[model samples]
Target: MKKNLLIIPSIIFTFVLLTFFYLLVIERNPSELPSNLLNKDIPIFEAENLIKNKKFISTNEFGNEIILVNFFATWCKPCRDEHSYIKQFNNNGIRVIGINYKDDPKKTIQWLEKLGNPYSDIPIDKHGRIAIDWGVYGIPETFLVNSKGIIKFRHVGPMSKKVFKKINLLIKEIK
Candidate 1:
């Protein structure tokens, strides 16, 4: 009976080790973390517009057409790196709402002016409340919301060429 107990525990330990090894070996995108908000309606909130001197209300901005909601900050290097890709999305006729996350308004304006703004609306999230509502994991997160205002896909971190292509394809598929 003593040997049987030891053998059973050993077997279970080995099985768990193998399962972990399999998971580590399998191909997976670490940046593609699952989001609780995926496939759900965007969280309702309103904020002052950074650029247009108007209120950026959640109810008014999302339902009519597909939109990209990008949470970015001036201090984040990755956000700067992905700015070109964000601009490309806008240039391709994708309406983008750039949420300025916990950043200084003056610096954000200067950053956009230097980078060439591509966002249709710039909402100020001074204390990161909007980002919290959206369940943003970090700066430079992007969400693809459908015409009906439901979030379809989310990408975290800097946008790379591969990611940009994947998003373009997703947009096509969504349409």
Candidate 2:
């Protein structure tokens, strides 16, 4: 009986080890984190505009055209790293709405000035309520929203050239 118990436990351990190795070998994109909001309407939100002296309303901004909704912060290095990619999107005629996540407005303004502002509208997520509502995992999170106001794709972490090309392709397809 003791030998049988030992064999069972060993078999179980071997199975677990094999499963772990299989997962490690499988293809997966770490940046492609699952989001509940995918294929759904963007969360309704209103926030003070960092640049314009007016409120930024979600309903007004999203349904008109395809937009890139980016959650960013001045304090995040990854956000800074992705700024150029964001600018590339803007340069290519993609409308971008940057949600300033838990950051100081003054610092954000200065950062924009230094980096060249790529966002059409800068919405201040002062207390991170907007980010939470969007199911944001971290700074530099980006969502691609269709013209009909549905979220089509989400990417987390700093944008790379590979990701930039992928997003551009997606935009073309979405269009």
Candidate 3:
């Protein structure tokens, strides 16, 4: 009986240690930045437009237009919630492009239909390679790029009117 009691405590201790190690060491902190690419040239990516599915979208498509690149996923609630703000940005003459992160074309289409499409162009990043290139750690991140293709601002979560106003000011400054 004493041996069993000791074994139970040992097992509990081992489990606690393993849990601590997994949480603190093995798992990565989600907020960690792998690189400092902000305020630099927007990374170029080539992806198929989710709407058309025939043509490809690349950095070159932006041309001289200031671009707002939004990284979103169909499953993300915040991405759905931010759709109206994105529409407002688009209506304000800000060019908006969407990078659909690791989502199915059919589901993406359905999500857009439900939320109302706000993007001037929506590209499918089925593998998330483009998101990795842009240093996106989470969905619903946005980057404001200038006409020259330099990233001027990055917002890492659901956008609001206050953030939109700041982006608008940056756009005016860049223009």
Show the colliding residue pairs in model 3: none
Q: How big is the positional error of residue 36 in model 1, measured in Å on the Cα after superposition?
A: 0.2
**Tens digit of lDDT per residue, candidate 1, span 1-175?**
9999899989999999999999899977755679999999999999999999789899998899999999999999999999999999999999999999999999999999999999999999999989999998788999999999999999899999998998899899988
The per-residue C-alpha lDDT of model 3 at residue 142 equals 92
Per-residue error for 90 in candidate 2, Å, reads 0.1
- Where model 1 places Cα greater than 4 Å from the true spot, the runs are 1-18, 29-32
Candidate 3 residue runs with Cα over 4 Å from true position: 1-35
What is the clash count of model 2? 0
Against the true structure, what is every candidate's RMSD?
2.5, 3.3, 9.5
> Which digits, one per residue and each the tens of the lDDT, describe model 3 over residues 1-175?
9999999989999999999888888755466454467768877777888877566547567658898989989889898788888988888878899989999889888888887888878888889899989988888899888777878788888887888788888888888
Q: Whose lDDT is greatest here?
A: 1
**Higher-TM-score candidate among 2 and 3?**
2
Per-residue C-alpha lDDT of model 2 across residues 26-117, encoded as one tens digit per residue: 97675566999999999999999998988998888888899999999999999999999999999999999999999999999999999999
Clashing pairs in 2: none
